[model samples]
Target: MIINAFILFLSVALPGLLLTRMKSFSQKRIGYFLVFAGAYLFSMTVIHIIPDLFLSEEDPFKLGLYILIGFFLQKILENFSNGVEHGHVHSHGGYSIPYLLIALGLHSFLEGSIMTDSIHSNHRPDSVYSHGSSPKILLGIVMHKIPAALALMALLVAQLKNTKKAVLLLLVFALASPLGLFFSEFFGHSDVLPERYLVIFFAVVAGSFLQISTTIFIESDPHHKLNWKRFSISILGALAAVAAQIGF
Candidate 1:
């Protein structure tokens, strides 16, 4: 679990740091890649996570309710995050730095919590071939994080006079998700909470995934015109999501 958390931490932090050095990197180019990530996240949630959650014959309706809660929870988080989770960041000067950090941190933390179910499944012998959420979800998160971290670092650099201070703030945001994962793994193993609760939590995360991905697809091309490149990338993403489920 620690190893997995560390990988996720790097995924969240390293890209922004690298972006700071790559002066030639284009946000528009990054935006194209983000479309692929968004599509994969949406496809994975709908193809894998949601079906797994609804598979529970017991109180399936309750799982749906939790998903709705998660969807709204993300909407509220965006009020402060400025849509950073979906790669939306602006250089506007009037925004509150503290509020932005808090919102991003909370969203990252919730994202990490979604991994607990995967961790638990890894410990079960029978789950080896079971249909469950794939670790590829981590890949999707990391893919999105690269652009998110870039946007965040850009915002921080624009707002703070000191480079080191901006980097430090970025590091804080990076740690939020891994910290959430670590805590969730610890508590999950302590046997304090029932496994059923974890399922509901996963469902909630799925809801958030749905909301973010759909928003990205809709907003990525505001003109609503047919763009073959993006459309093909999105199809590829969905294919990748399906392939991941088949032990790719």
Candidate 2:
């Protein structure tokens, strides 16, 4: 767990420092960054989180419910975020920063929770490191950081012009996921990590991804109807998630 948190911390912090360099771009570039980050995280969730879920002893019905539950919770978050995760950086009178920071922190931690939970649930001391989420969770958190980091860095550069402040904010952003992982590992070790709670948590993760992706689509191209491309891709994401749930 310690190793996982450390790695996750670096994953998030590095992107933040990197974001300090993107100060001259137009809003379009910022939006593009958000799109890229969202896409990247979505892919990772499909490719990683879903598979973890499948490998665990969780059942199909429960998994489905988790998805629905994730969907709604993410929806609520989106409403509060005003679609920030989708790429549009609408400031709510300077309230956006603190609100976003807190939201991102919560989001990161939950994601990390999924990883640590997986490890503790499935791994024994003699087991390979393959089961612990320290790595994948790290990747997901890093990937998740890109969008927010990009937006935050760009804004900071445009106005604050203080690399130090930008970097500091970025570190704060990076810690969110690791913090989540910390709680996950802690709760898991207490022998109190109930299956029902995990099911709900997984549902939230899946839902957040779905909500963010769909929100991006709606914001980017509202008239864009659900064509085969989106449908197929979404199904692929769902399948990937399902497979992860059952340990495949």
In terms of TM-score, which candidate is strongest?
Answer: 1
Q: Which of the numbered candidates is closest to the native, going by highest lDDT?
A: 1
Error of 1 at 160 (Å): 1.1
Q: CA lDDT of each candidate?
A: 0.78, 0.60
Enumerate residue pairs that collide in model 1: none
Error of 1 at 192 (Å): 1.0
Model 2: lDDT of residue 83: 54
Candidate 2, residues 1-248, lDDT tens digits: the string is 77777777776666557755544446655555444445545666666566556655677677877877787886776565555445455664353556666666666676666667554455343433335444544554455555556565555555466778867877877677777777766666666877556656766787677677656656545677654554554455445433443442
- Show how many residue pairs clash in every candidate, following the order shown: 0, 17
Those runs of model 1 whose alpha carbons end farther than 4 Å from true positions after fitting are 91-93, 118-134
Give residue 47's lDDT in candidate 1 (0 to 100): 72
Model 2: CA > 4 A from native: 25-40, 54-59, 86-88, 91-95, 117-137, 156-167, 217-248
TM-scores for candidates 1 onward, in order? 0.90, 0.68
What lDDT tens digits, residue by residue, belong to model 1 across residues 1-248? 67668877898678878867877577777878889999988988887677666655438789889999989988888888878788877545566899989988888887887766543453334542343443776888888788888888887887796768888998888898888788777766768877677777777888888888988888777899978888888889888887887763
